[model samples]
Target: MEGKEQNRQEGIPLQFCKNKTKRRDKSFNVYIKTFGCQMNKYDSEILEGLLKTRGFTLTPHIEYADIALFNTCSVREHAERRVYGQVNMLSPQICSLGKSKRGDNYPNKRIIGVIGCMAQAHKEKIFDRLPQVDLVCGPQNLYNIPDYLEDIAKNNKRILAVDRRERPVDRENFSFRNKRRYLTAYVTIMEGCNNFCSYCIVPFVRGREVSRPPSLIIKEIEVLIKKGAKEVTLLGQNVNSYGRDFNNGYNFIQLLKDIDKMHELRRLRFITSHPKDASDEMFIAMSKLPTVCESLHLPIQSGSDKILKSMNRKYTREDYLRKVDILRKLIPEVSLTTDIIVGFPNETDEDFAETIDIMKRVQFDTAYIFKYSPRPYTQAARLEDNVPKKVKEERHQELLRLQKNITLSNNKKLINRKVGVLVESADEKGDYLIGRSRTDKVVIFKGPKELIGKIVEVRIIDASLANLKGEWIRL
Candidate 1:
């Protein structure tokens, strides 16, 4: 099961926020380092726009940049720790660059900032220990770029713009810069999560779900498609919960049907669906919609009903299998993937076996297995995380080993089959191009650069547990 990004938005920049300075000025280079899900990746794109509008030039190398910003995550403690280590490693280098400037042509002083979920979760604490950090802003305050900078200049060495009480909705006018390199684009349908699962800090850090207007969503998709995007992945913490709180009763399934009805778009996909909200309507739309990918990344965190109850996942083991049943019945060719947490507090041997049993029953095409980690303020943090760290480590490996054979068996069945792949980039051997089939399987094949941005047929000749090796079949 591939774990999907829990919180993010497709960032469009605001022309209204443009600063008076040279474009890509050598004096000011802003480099954004992103970690975590697709949402964070998309947010980096928006961050790029916000910075570009402010006359800051983007830099590929972090060492060369005057502003090193991290759009980070808080799903796992390790994710946050990596950010801390990175900032710590660069603090001295940033200071050195600031001091070593020879003249006006050398460069300006550097500032380190942490934005997005990790910023919301740690707030000033991320800056407290690392005094070199100039700014910390949450996902909702991304549009407050100018003011956050203003405060920093006014004798504020460290400033955090996280509002735990009231989520500041600083909406920006949408204008994308340096578009993602692919026919596929992740267009966010909503921001935040309401689930607040016991072991997760997403809801607290990212806030409740707020969907973009269906019109805005449609407009965004249309723009991406016009910009040579052939496929779109509707990203959200819980995508199936789309339109639940909106005035328009247009649900995720309805959105699929609407998008499918559109001409020119070759493929469509959505991710990280909660098991509960993947309703009959969404499944039905998936079954009927021509462009919707046959793959669904529905996360079933735990298999045992007792463990699920503890995790506050809202679905039992049987309930999850029912979803697979519905999807298989509706679209027999549909590929299924899932996320499994191998160890959670109080999980017994029986619970662990039940999870393995569930895996055997469903035979997910792929699965992402993670050992549970206690996140601060999450409900599970209060519970006794009595599962031994070593035991958790062992269980995680067991799940991974099992999943390897399961995935390989599934891939083996596809050898010599012809599938449509949307070429995104080249494979490990640059001579061949790499793309994903509508079933969301990664396929590699030889093709000209012109083959990109268009769906091409590939004949699978070789198979690996992770991806399919194939050759392009010209139509």
Candidate 2:
């Protein structure tokens, strides 16, 4: 997933069908197995919206599904491998149905497809590997999935829709898809990335940066707010570089200011900001905006200048520190989270020490640490992956151990304090309700079922490296 964002269930309105009188048969079901970032989840929501319009309902059980879609990711080799394994596992069951013959029930024959980054990256090669795949669509072509699925059903042949052109999002089209009455929702303000980080495959698979029109974005948020969304998270590959593609003066900071004017909104958040593009003006806006949450997911891939430069990250260690210092000064109570990659090629013991040093200085509330893995067709792939697997594991464990101590220490201070939490869901065990604080910390507390979609004050009673145990104070 992009920047290690946790996956969550996206809501789809129960009455999304075009005709109010027409009831869905629930015979034909589409099962979407998403394996990527929040953007991919948004894409899956769009897919669900499109399918619901076409009279198909989503099903959790793949065995009973008429169509199974794998929304894939290529950020890491492991993600891709998982997709491959899933496809392979499902191929036999799909193939056993055989071709659609005369007088046969078309609904009985399953259709399997792959969408998103991995589909865009592999294209037809995906067919060569997984011959059972009936459709392969890219992220840009998601809106056209129903049409392609229709064509496949009519002709009984495979199809691919991986257009590279910049596609405009139809916010009005998917307005009814916000089914969740949760206080928080994700609004993708932009798509793709322009920064070609050497080890990253996002730019290649997701294409270049394209910011949605501000008017459309604001309108979408308004629709969401009207439907009971209290917080909106602006998503992008690099949110800080949102308006750079446009000739107009509209930028991310300006967008934030515009959204801040929406008094109905209680909080706003954004993610995956590149350190170099995180301007001081943006931090200032964040500090002043009452709706903007006091949390930032700024990913500093590495702390060693040599490793950063080699990864084409553009910012030096000191430059990132300066930005962090500025942000801390402006928002004293802000919670900082970061993404770190260990054992990059040519990194020495001293370089690893620099990463630990920076972690101590920054004291990030949470850190997502990943071991270096060279991606195909990326600049780093050409270089030798000289770091041994054992060494990488050691470095990863060391960083994780260090970050856990820091996180636990930091969280300990929150005990006996009160914080507002937006209740999202009950834990799997059903013993406690799980939600997030304004600072994005996971808080678990016992509460009524009615509190699932509302924000309430909670008093922290216990703390751990990963989450906080709290007691409900009030709604």
**Which candidate achieves the best TM-score against the true structure?**
2
Candidate 2 accuracy as lDDT = 0.82
Q: If scored against the real structure, what TM-score would every candidate get?
A: 0.89, 0.90
List of clashing residue pairs for candidate 2:
none
lDDT, candidate 1, 233-270, per-residue tens: 99999988888887767777777788887787888989
Candidate 1 segments exceeding 4 Å error: 1-27, 95-109, 150-156, 164-172, 180-182, 427-429
Query: What is each predicted model's overall lDDT from 0 to 1?
Result: 0.77, 0.82
lDDT of 2 by residue, 1-475 (tens): 1111111112111111121221235335678999979898878877787788877668888865667899999898889999999988873244222223102433235678899999888887887788767788888878778777666555555677787776544545655363535467788888888889999999988888989889988988888888788889999999998888888888999999999999999889998799999999999999999999999999998989999999999999999999999999999889999999998899999999999999999999989999998887799999899999999999999999999999999999999999999888897888899999999999999988788878899999999988999999863
Ten residues in a row with the worst lDDT in model 1?
1-10
